[model samples]
Every structure is written in structure tokens, then in C-alpha cells.
Target: MADPLLVVPVREGTATVSLRLFRTATGDRTAVAFSSPLALARVLGPGQRWIRLSAPALRHMVADLGVTGIVLDPAGTLPPRSPATGHDVHRLRVA
Candidate 1:
């Protein structure tokens, strides 16, 4: 089985960030949890408009999928605020 995909619905305010473990081939979606802005920020990173999920969260998500690696797609979504001057990707390790 392929590694599950983590779908993050990013929006403004204290919106719900759904963490779904989906399998492409089977079209299966497992609702891992619904994370809040503050909670997500604790795991990912700070977002200008939307909340971010930390590296540990990413690692944990991938680990739960029984895979060593998984893709992190922001779903072409961003916060309502204008883009800020900073690095797009944050480097993180799973240990």
C-alpha cells in the first residue's frame, strides 16, 4: 500500500484543520483528528493567516500511515493576509 496522504484544509480564524489519512488507490479517508489553529501551530509552525502544523505532527501522521515518508501539500491554500517575506518550507526531521 502507498503512503497515506495528509489533507489539511487551511482557512482563516480558528477553523478546523482536518487530518485525513487517505489512500489514493483505494480512495479511503480515515479521519485522524480535527486540529485547531492553536494546536496545529504547536506542531507545524506559525502561519500569517492560517494555522500551521509542526514537524512532529507531520512525522507522527506519516508514522501512523505506516510509512517513512509522505507528501505535504498545502492544497494551494494560504492565509487571508498578504504573503510574508520568509522561507516557504521549514526543514524538520523524524527521530
Candidate 2:
């Protein structure tokens, strides 16, 4: 099976973050930074392989996307607050 695509919310302008997933006209999966949950709902109806990302992994993924100045809550459910930086490539393992 193909590896599941990872979607990280890079920018959260409000108390709740919006999620969006889309396939371009040319058939390429694309996600916009700071998108809306309504848009995500429109795309993801059922049987999608979506998963919540750990804090560390989420930081790494966003950095990979060239985002900066991210602040995660210290008391968040995800552990290991240290952000991973200066890596050319990152790999996420899902079980």
C-alpha cells in the first residue's frame, strides 16, 4: 500500500485550526497553509487515512515546509517539546 500522506497545519490564526485537503486539477495532492476545516470536510468524506501528528513530528514537518516562528503549547498532549531543525530530510513512521 502507498504511504499515507501527512497533513500538518502550518499556521493557526485562531483558537481552532482549520484543515484542508485537495487534489489539483492535474491530480496532485495539495494542502494550503492556514486552510479551513469546512474545506477539509468537503474533501474528506469517509475512509481517509488521516492521523494526528505528535508535536515533535508536527514541528519537523512544518519546518520542512519552510515555516518559522511556531509556538506549541507546553501542556499539549503530544510530548517531547524539543523541535527538530537542520535536517534535509525527515521520515515519519506510522504503524
Worst 10 residues of 1 by lDDT: 86-95
lDDT of 2 by residue, 1-95 (tens): 54333333332324744332223334333332213333333333232223445445545554544443233211111111123541212211111
lDDT of 1: 0.38
What tens-digit string does per-residue lDDT give for candidate 1 at 5-55? 333424333554434333323333322212455443444446523434554
lDDT of 2 at 2: 42
TM-score of each: 0.26, 0.24
Query: What is the overall TM-score of model 1 with all chains considered together?
Result: 0.26
TM-score of 2: 0.24
lDDT of each: 0.38, 0.32
